[model samples]
Target chain A: MSIFETIRFALRGLVANKLRSGLTVLGILIGVGAVILLVAVGNGSAKVIEESIESLGTNTLTISSGGFGRQSSTSTSSTSLTVELATALADQSAAPHVKTVSPVVTSSSLAATYEDTDVTVGSFIGTHPDYATASNFSIKSGAMFTTDDVNDHSKVVVLGSTVAEGLFGTVDPLGQQINVSGKLFTVIGVLAEKGSSGLSDPNDLAIAPLSAVQESLTGYGSLSQILVQAVSADDIDTAQAEVTSILNEKLGVTSTSSSTPYRIMNQAELLETRTSNAKTFTTLLGAVAAISLLVGGIGITNIMMVTVTERTREIGIRKALGAPKRTVLNQFLVEATVLSVIGGLLGVAGAVIGSQFTIMGTKPVIVPSSVLLALGVSVGIGLFFGSYPASRAASLRPIEALRYE
Target chain B: MSAHRANRPVLDVRNAKKIYGSGEATVVALAGVSLTVHRGEYVAIMGSSGSGKSTLMNILGCLDIPTTGRYLLDGVDVSKLNDRQLALVRNRRIGFVFQSFNLIPRTTALANVELPMAYAGVRSAERKRRAHAALDLVGLADRADHEPNQLSGGQQQRVAVARALVTAPALVLADEPTGNLDTQSTADVLAVLDSLNQSGRTIVLITHEDDVAMHAKRVIRLVDGKIVSDQRNGHLAASRSAMLRDAYSTAVYR
Candidate 1:
């Protein structure tokens, strides 16, 4: 018989058993839906991590002194890291893979004011002129603080986009003065909006000359964290190792135990780890969902076998009417394929709809390739598991089947 | 006899033998049985249970192969044909009706009638036309859209007859076609078969009922895997009684 005719007959057979076919379709639907939803959430989180890494600059690394363990208060300790050590690490001769180093000193919950209006600063940071290049920030209007400013301890500051908008209300704040921590500092430049980088919100902080924040607000010798930029993304590991050893030597930490009091984080490695973690989560979820598809395939085989047994006499009738074995086989196989395909289509629709809602603070993003793969796998499950029952139907002897009653 | 009897017989078997089981459980269903049926002849083979009548019908319908025999169907050596080739012969040259009126359930009368044509790879439009005509022949044209369950027993049996005739086979094989029907339904089915035979359609019917066998122009009686009598229906009453007496004596002696 022609394939189209066989398909028509198979459709009729499925229709004849509506509840059974519907249940089978629901099984496959849940399987395919789970795969799509899990993969979408995985890809969504991966994309978010990738964007954060890009914002942080892949070639950058952060060095924090005496903070290897969670219990370490070395960030607040005055003896671990100083401006002089940061200046030494910034030298190309000391760390050849290093491109630039910016020493940071942060004071949180600082209130800034311009005339009568004021905005609460999330963070007030102190750093050198190379801070723009190290952290991928750029001056939008005015210039960054000069080396002379650092040496002279000039009371000049660069406001981030959020800080500038809040203090001056869209007015050019470059020539304005703002009082930070009860001290006045000139706004030399406004930094461009760089969004959050998982470390901090660059758009909500302010930058000042390192000497000024250390002398005026913090009144401490220790640096908060040092931002280091490698010459290229490939040099991040080399730059991180150089920064780690340089800090260990400066802090008088011994190298015999391979234990350094400093922690170095390479943005590239962090990005890779986060992305791989997302992929692992996706694969685990996909595997669990795939088991359902396998079970659905087994369900199909079971139903088809039951169908074959139940219709033994009908099969005998068809065989007696001159149906070839191939025809009988094709009929059942096509029935199974139709079931899976329809279920897959419904699953795709469900996933697409379900992706619009957020689950656990992350919205799913339906990926076209994963959708295609899920559909392909479901169809494959149908064909792979449908073969046994189809062949059983085909191999039935007309004489015995007719006598089966 | 028709002129086709002198030509190639519609079906011919030479010493057909069928055996079931083996060793201590061995049972020979058909032993050295031979027969020839000509074109356009209506014949019935009557036997009690275990008489091998069903085995002979299966062989005649190409549903089973004889263990030791040469059976020619529509002039082809069906005994030597492979399974696939035999299926083709059954599709193209033979049509079958069963005692249960085995029309596929949940299928309309028309689709059931078109089933054999579908297997023969006939086009949809032509198959539909031929199926409708066949249903009309059995006076079921108006009930073409009804499912088997929706039809009465007599109507369902007529639909089965229509399905068998739709393929225009070389011969029709009916195994107790009226076995499950009431008296009126049985009469209705018999009238349909009688008309088809009168229209020169070749039919081979297997039954244990003397009334059913009496409708055929020729009757063959089987006793314990052997045909003890083969004759025209005018002397069926006498021949059936003699055959039964001989079979009873043989059974008692054994």
Candidate 2:
């Protein structure tokens, strides 16, 4: 028979029993839809992390205590990072990509007031002149604190755009005095609006000179940590290797069992880890969804087998009329493949709608490539499941089938 | 079994055997049966229920392979031909009609005739043309668009006959083709089959009614899978043939 007639015959058979065909297709749709939705959500979260890493301070290398991880120390257990070490690293001329660096003396309890409404911000950083340059902060108003500001204990501060707005709305608060825990400090500069960058919240920060923050309210001479910036993004690898060696030596640490002294997270490592984590998550969810698709194929197999039994006389009639086994096999296979193709297309449509429904307003949204791959997998499912029942139908003896009541 | 040599019978079978089930529990459906059908001959095989007449029909139709025996179809050993080859032979050399007027339900008369050729892989245009010619031969040309359920019993049988004739096969196998029709319908279907046979087509019919078998030129009575009597109708079909020719000529003249 002509190819068109074969399809026409198969389509007629499906149309003859509409509800059965719909139910079969329904199984496939849910399988494909689940795969698409599960994979999209997992990959989307990973993309958010990547976006945070990319928009962080440009050319900056972040170093923290490694191996020991978080909760290694509240005070004096692990290797202590000092401002003197940060100063030593900054004074290097041999490292060409080495740029301005800063040592941070961060603490939680820092108070500030402009008019009267002063909310205690959670974060505070005490650093040098290079702190502003290395952190990618663009001053919106007055100048950054000079190296002399740290040396002379000048109580000067620069507020992030959000913190500036919260304390002194629309009013130009530059050249004004802000009380920091009962001590007056001049707001020399206000940062321009560059929203949240990586782990740092744009709001809730108050920058102060390293010497004044240590001597006045804090009353401690120790540094919490240090920050470094490279001249360019490409120099991150070279800069990270040099900075690691310096911090390990400076922190007074010998690599021991309980601690590796300090930790480090550079721009390159951050991006690399995020991508690998996303791949793992996407694969895990995709596999779960694929199982559902396989279940759908089994559903088709179940239905085709029933159809064979129900149409026993029809098979008898065709066989007696000289229909070869291959012909009978093709007929059933066509029916299954047609059902799967329809289901797969419907699944793609459902996934697209789901992406819009779930993602809300997050940027750098996940792009689903597996939805298409899943559809192709469904076609293979049809061939896989359809084969057994078709072979069974073909194997039927014409005389015995005809004799069936 | 009778001897069949070169330039001999079109179909020859010797000691054919067909057993249902296996070993100690087997029931023999056809036991050492033998028969022959020549080209351009009309033969009727008759038997009651459990007499294995239907089983013989199935084997002759190539729908079932015989368990043991040498059955030669036009001098080729059918016992040796595989399932696929037997299917090819059935498509090219044999056509079938059933007592139930086994035209596919809801199909038009033309499509019913076209169905056999379709399986034979004939091109669509040729299949359509040949089906139309077969319908014309059965006097169902004007009822070409009539579905089996829409037509009268006689017309439906004529359509079945048309289906059997469309492929121009060497043999037309009718298993009690007129069993379900009334006397008038039976006469109509018999007249159609008679005309086909007169046109040099070989036909084998299976029926339990002696009245039905009277239309054939030869009769083989089967009992319990064994042939009890095999005889020629002798001068009965010759007289009937002349009578049918006169009747058709008068109808055409009118």
Winning model by lDDT:
1
For model 2 chain B, the run of ten residues with the poorest summed lDDT? B1-10
CAPRI accuracy category, model 2: acceptable
Cα lDDT, model 2, residue B190:
92
Angstrom error of the Cα, residue A146, model 2: value is 7.3
Which DockQ value does candidate 2 get?
Answer: 0.46
Candidate 2 C-alpha error for residue A382, in Å: 1.1
Estimate TM-scores for all models. Answer: 0.81, 0.83
lDDT of 1 by residue, B1-254 (tens): 23343346678989999999999998999998999886667899999999999999999999999999899997899988888898899998898888889899999999999999998999999999999989998999999999999999989999999999877776899999999999999999999998876665678999999998989889999998999999897454543443344334324422
Interface RMSD in angstroms for candidate 2: 1.7
Whose DockQ is greatest here?
A: 1
Residue-level lDDT tens digits of model 1 in A1-405:
888999999999999999999998998898888889888988877777787777779999887765445225344443456778888888888799999888899998799999988999998988888888777788899989898999899999998899999999868898899998789999999988885656566689898988899899998767888888898988888888888788767777676744566678788888889889888987887788778778888888888888889888889889998999989999999988999999898989999999999965677888898899889988998888888988999999999888897
Q: Lowest lDDT 10-mer window, candidate 1 chain A?
A: A70-79
Candidate 1 — which residues are off by over 4 angstroms? A63-101, A107-124, A129-206, A218-225, A229-264, B1-6, B234-254
